[model samples]
Target: MSVEPLIELKGICKNFGEKMILNDIELNIYPGEALVIIGPSGAGKSTLLRIIAGLLAPDTGEIYIKGQNRQGLIEDKQDPIGISMVFQQSALFDSLTVAENVGFCLYQHSKLPERKIRQLVEEKLEMVGLPGISHQYPAELSGGMRKRVSFARAIMSNPDDSRYNPEVILYDEPTAGLDPIASTVIEDLVRRLQQAAQVCGTYVMVSHQESTIRRTADRVVFLYEGQIQWEGKVQDIDITDNLLVRQFFSASIDGPIRVIN
Candidate 1:
């Protein structure tokens, strides 16, 4: 891992009405390491992921992208590096074809010619194991296929500029709602992309699926009620005696985690 962090969160805090979603949170994402954030539903895992991606701002804190303090939201300030995010719902545009959806950013922002953009789109789709379907619409695909398309979109970058390529990605439940086999395929794809030259090796994911977390993460962080309760390597999950971790993995009703109705 690199000595300098690619992304950093310091004293992060967020609130919704009277409820606190994240409290004094701090995290660092290093290069070449895949980290997974896991916790019960409503544990603010996704919220934290969004904040890190700069899609949502924290109520109080600072976000540093590649050691430089971020000036504004992702759109406002062009950071030194790119940080991409894949939403849980596979948020593809219904009106656009797969190629258009994957290449939306480039189509709208880049000066690259249409032919070159199409070629890049095909390459990204192929990288995600969904080649030759660029002409199809998102509605024509299955849930898993749509998710993969979204993955391709998230990794899409302008070949003319390295700033468009993300050094870190945030995945919000990429494998959710898929069958076991489909989930495994997505999990494997995530790991494979980690090694791909076009994609960044470092990523942060928020997932509830045990297999996805275990298979994808080099390190794991457990969040509960707006705070980190436990964090360790993937191997530590099985041996950690932390009450929260044990209760979460075992799905037991009795523990420090409060059950909400």
Candidate 2:
């Protein structure tokens, strides 16, 4: 792991009108690591992901990318380095074919020719294990296929050759709404993508799924009540005695975490 942080969140605080979503979040995302943020629903996990992706600006905080201040700068627009986001919903254009969706960024941003773009798209599709379906539209594909297509689109560029390939990929609920089998497939793909040499990058994911948290995280952060309650390594989760952590992992409602009716 690199000593220098790939992404940093310093004093991140977000408020939606009157409700506080995130409170004084301080974090360091290292290079080539899978950092998973786990939290209950409406805990602002996705909001935090958006902030890191530079989609949403925090009310008060400093976002540093490779040690450069990125305040008020939307990362997607005029970002110095590559950062990609896989949204909770597979936000694909239904009209566009799988190939078009995967290659959209390349065609719009790069000077690469159509043939080269197509080739890159095919390569990415194959990387996600969904080759030969490029000609098909998103409507015809399963939910899992659409999600993988979104991933391919996010990582289609080459990180070493060009600055366009994402150095960091933010996943917002990657395995949401999928059956156990399909969820396992998505989890396997995420693990494979991070380990693959061709497109390995730092990944930060927000999920409520316990299996996803265990399978994909190199480190885990538990966000609740708009703050980080506890955080530790993936293995430590099983041994920790923290009330919130134990209750969360075991799905025990008779502990410190109470549901108000």
Candidate 3:
């Protein structure tokens, strides 16, 4: 691991009306590692992922990327390094074609020609195993296909500026609704994308699926009751005696975690 973290969160807290989501959260994302967060629904994993992506601001906390403290949301100021996120919903625009959606950033910001942008968009789509559907609309694709399109968009790059290449990726329930085989494909894609990242093969994922957590995670953190109750390496999760880990993995009705109706 590097001497410094690529991303760091200190005392992160968030709330929605009367309920508090994340509480006093702290984490560090090191280079060349796949970190996964696992917990039941309403555990605040997705919220923390957005905060790290700079898409959402915490009620109280600090976020640092590449050692520079982030001020306000991503629209307020750009981070020192590139950070991208694949949202849980696949969040694609109904009107735009897959190519348009994937190259949205470059189209809006870069000086690249339209032809070049299309080529780059196709390249990214192929990287995610979604080739030759750039002209199709999001509504025309299947759920897994749309998610792959979103993945393509998240990994899109600005050829004019190498600094814009993504260093860290935040994934929110990437395999949520997919079939087992499809979910496995998505997991493989995540690992492949990490190897293709510009600066480091680093990614942070939020998942509840046992296969995903075990296959993709180099390290795992267990979140519950608005905090990380346990953390360890991927294999450690099986052997660790942490009550949270034990209960979560076992799918037990009895433990510190009580299921919500």
Candidate 1 residue-wise lDDT, 196-236, digit = tens:
97688999999999999999999999999899888899999
TM-score of 1: 0.98
- In TM-score terms, which candidate is top? 1
Question: On TM-score, who's better, 1 or 2?
Answer: 1
As a whole number from 0 to 100, the lDDT of residue 133 in candidate 3 is 96
TM-score of each: 0.98, 0.95, 0.96
lDDT score for residue 79 of model 3: 89
Q: Write down the lDDT that model 1 would get.
A: 0.92
Better of 1 and 2 by lDDT: 1
Q: Candidate order by TM-score, highest to lowest?
A: 1, 3, 2
lDDT for model 2, please. 0.88
Which of the two, 1 or 3, has more lDDT? 1
Write the candidate numbers in order of decreasing lDDT.
Answer: 1, 3, 2
Candidate with more favorable, higher lDDT: 2 or 3 = 3
Overall lDDT per candidate, in order of appearance: 0.92, 0.88, 0.89
Q: Model 1: clashing residue pairs?
A: none
- 212, model 2: CA deviation in Å? 1.0
Query: Which ten-residue region of model 2 has the weakest summed lDDT?
Result: 71-80
